[model samples]
Target: MSPEYAIEGAFSIKSDVYGFGVLMIEIVTGKKNRFFTHPDHNLNLLGHTWKSYNEDRLSELIDASILESSDQDEVFRVIAIGLLCVQQYPEDRPTMSSVMKMLTSNITLPRPKQPGFFTERKLEEADTSHSMLCLSSSNHSITTLAPR
Candidate 1:
């Protein structure tokens, strides 16, 4: 790995954890993980997911588009898992090892309280050439020369 990738690799496990969080959010909401807009709130899907989790109405974050096809228990579990990954403190978040255990095993995973806000994407100002210089868990991890 390049020095930049090496840096990101240092954080790779945590980054994968974050990606899992976004994936779970996408699965529950039937929306892309990036740039979601809700009618009532200006916050993106991550924000909405965080709000729903915090408000004890995480079920509300489930997308109406696929409601009937979803399993409520599994959905809730995934939501909780997502929130766990998105915790603001890296230490509070599960490592991929723990995440895999949480997903596959019957062990009782810790309850996830709530997720912090996901940083917004700012593609307009992004530099196409040097985008590969870094990897980021926040925003879209464009390979920009910006700090990872």
Candidate 2:
């Protein structure tokens, strides 16, 4: 939603893609990707899923809590939809309408490419960049707000 990444007048379809990916992760893991951390590298849920997927361990992305609530076929379908939402190229991502159909129907989905910020290394860099400016501005605000 930040202007830094805006494609047009407002946050574009790609932004929705990011949101869909987050929702998918949340649905599978019963966890929020923003705050979920991995035991190994302290990576967030998205990074953890990407790592697992890369290693051909897709089932690892699923949460035990959802085992009863989730249908295996539906789970796989949603996972594929999520991956489509997070594709690096905006053009490759499906619109919300397409996403809805993909989720509800038995349509064959396109394979998703490596997602943006999929790797821990890339995610770390993105996290650093995203926070650096905000932190610096907040510090400045604190100094200005305090008695001099």
Candidate 3:
């Protein structure tokens, strides 16, 4: 669930891209994004990845099992593309076709902006078991009776 769809109930192809991005990160790290935890930080896997990438510490995020078998540069590029997919806005993500080309080509990859869902969550504010969305609570009342 991309942040937009999760919070606003708006869905699009970009929503799937966000999902794919999460998949990519999990594949590379061998950790589930939702359940991933770090000893020093409360960042989810996606947030951790964003922080690692920015710090040029992506090497720390790769699965050691895959590291030996995979080309480091290629893996880094995939991670970068994954980051691009999970950017803060759906409009910022590339189309699926563009993603494919990026994966296959050596073209210069754009620097990804901050990722969505990268913030430390306040679990108390919402029911984490059902949803992480924090929609504002409001009430409505009928001031007058209407016959319609």
Candidate 4:
């Protein structure tokens, strides 16, 4: 789930864009976004990818099998596009059409900002606080469904 959907109850075309980004990252890395792990950091796949990209270690983010078979530059471009779709704010993320252009053309892609839901701990904290606020309020049974 995108951070805005989980934390702020906001959903839009941008949310689908975020989901697409996560899917692309999973395909490129051969790892599930929810289960990604690195011994050296607490970041999720998106956070790790962003860090790797910034540190010039993006090649390390790809799956070994993909690395052996795929063109490195193309893989990097896909990863960059994925990161672009998952930026923290909807406004920061590219439109789907823009993403397509970036993927298909040689146009220069903008650098990605930090991704939504970058750390599990931060999400947990937000959920905890929200639960506490709910409990303290008079209305304790209200539930709302987020639009998919």
Candidate 5:
């Protein structure tokens, strides 16, 4: 959920935009944000992606299985658009039309600010801990929620 809807019980089209952004990032990463984990950090995929961008290590965010086959530039472009869609404030996120333009055009995009709902904590607390996990396809997926 977007921070507003998750924390404040607020709802708006921006919230949908946030979900859209999450979907984009999820698609690009080939991983779900909710069950994301990293052995070296306690960030969910969202936090990790933001950190990766700020650290000039965004390339590390790509799923290895697809990295070799996908155009790096296009992948990064989509990541950029995804980040823009999940900006912290609802007013800061793009409209659906804006997203379409972003996907279809080569317009220079503004730097995306921090995404909403960023949280950092150990993966041991993942909500899926008590549930059975069924991993497959190069062991890259989980079937439970793991919000930050």
Candidate 6:
């Protein structure tokens, strides 16, 4: 879930764009977002991707299928666009039309900021014993809107 949806009860077209970014990552990595994990860094897929990108090790995040069959530059470009869509603030994300242009054209893209929900805690640090207690659960279902 996007951080805004999880923390603020907010939903909009930008939220769907965030989901699209996640979907792109899943396709490129051939991994499920829900089950993504890194034992050493205690990061899910998005966090790991950000870390890899910042460290100049994004090749480690690509699926073998893509690596063997796709152009590396194109793959990297798509990943960058995905990260842009999942920025922490909705306003920081590009519109869907902008995304299409980015995908199809060679225009320069803005550097992606850190994504939402990014975490770097160790596995031990993630244990519930040290976590804050919350009295209620946040709903994760996407609220649908009818056409105006």
Full ranking by TM-score: 5, 3, 6, 4, 2, 1
| Best of the candidates, lDDT | 3
Q: For model 4, where is the 10-residue window of minimal lDDT?
A: 120-129
Q: Across residues 1-148, which tens digit of lDDT does each residue of candidate 3 receive?
A: 8999987778977999999998999999999876677777778889999999999999899999888899999999999999999988999999989999999999999999999999775444323632532333346443765543
Model 2 misplaced stretches (Cα beyond 4 Å): 1-10, 119-148
**Weakest 10 consecutive residues of candidate 5 by summed lDDT:** 128-137
lDDT of 1 by residue, 3-97 (tens): 22244445544666766787877877888754466667556577778778778787777887656787777777788888888775566789888
Question: Any runs in candidate 6 off by more than 4 Å, and if so which?
Answer: 120-148
| TM-score of each model, in listed order | 0.65, 0.68, 0.82, 0.79, 0.82, 0.80
- The whole-model lDDT of each prediction reads 0.67, 0.68, 0.87, 0.86, 0.85, 0.84
lDDT (tens digit, per residue) of candidate 6 on 1-148: 7778977778867998898899998899998665576766678788888888899887889999899999999999999999998899999999999999999999999999999878656555455423432323465445678553
Off by over 4 Å in 1: 1-12, 118-148
Residue 109 accuracy (lDDT) in model 5: 89
- Candidate 2 vs. true structure, TM-score: 0.68
Kindly indicate the candidate among 3 and 4 with the higher TM-score.
Answer: 3
Q: Write one digit per residue (lDDT tens) for candidate 4, span 30-138.
A: 9987757677876878888888989999888999999999999999999999998998899899999998899889999888888888774455654576577657877
| Superposed Cα deviation of residue 133, candidate 1 (Å) | 20
lDDT of 2 by residue, 1-148 (tens): 2121533345565677667776876788777765565657866566676676668676677887676677866786677688777766677778888988897899998877766555454556647855775678643543334332
How far is each candidate from the true structure, as Cα RMSD in Å?
7.4, 6.7, 7.5, 6.9, 6.4, 6.9
**Which structure among the candidates has the greatest TM-score?**
5
lDDT at residue 26 of model 3 (Cα atoms): 94
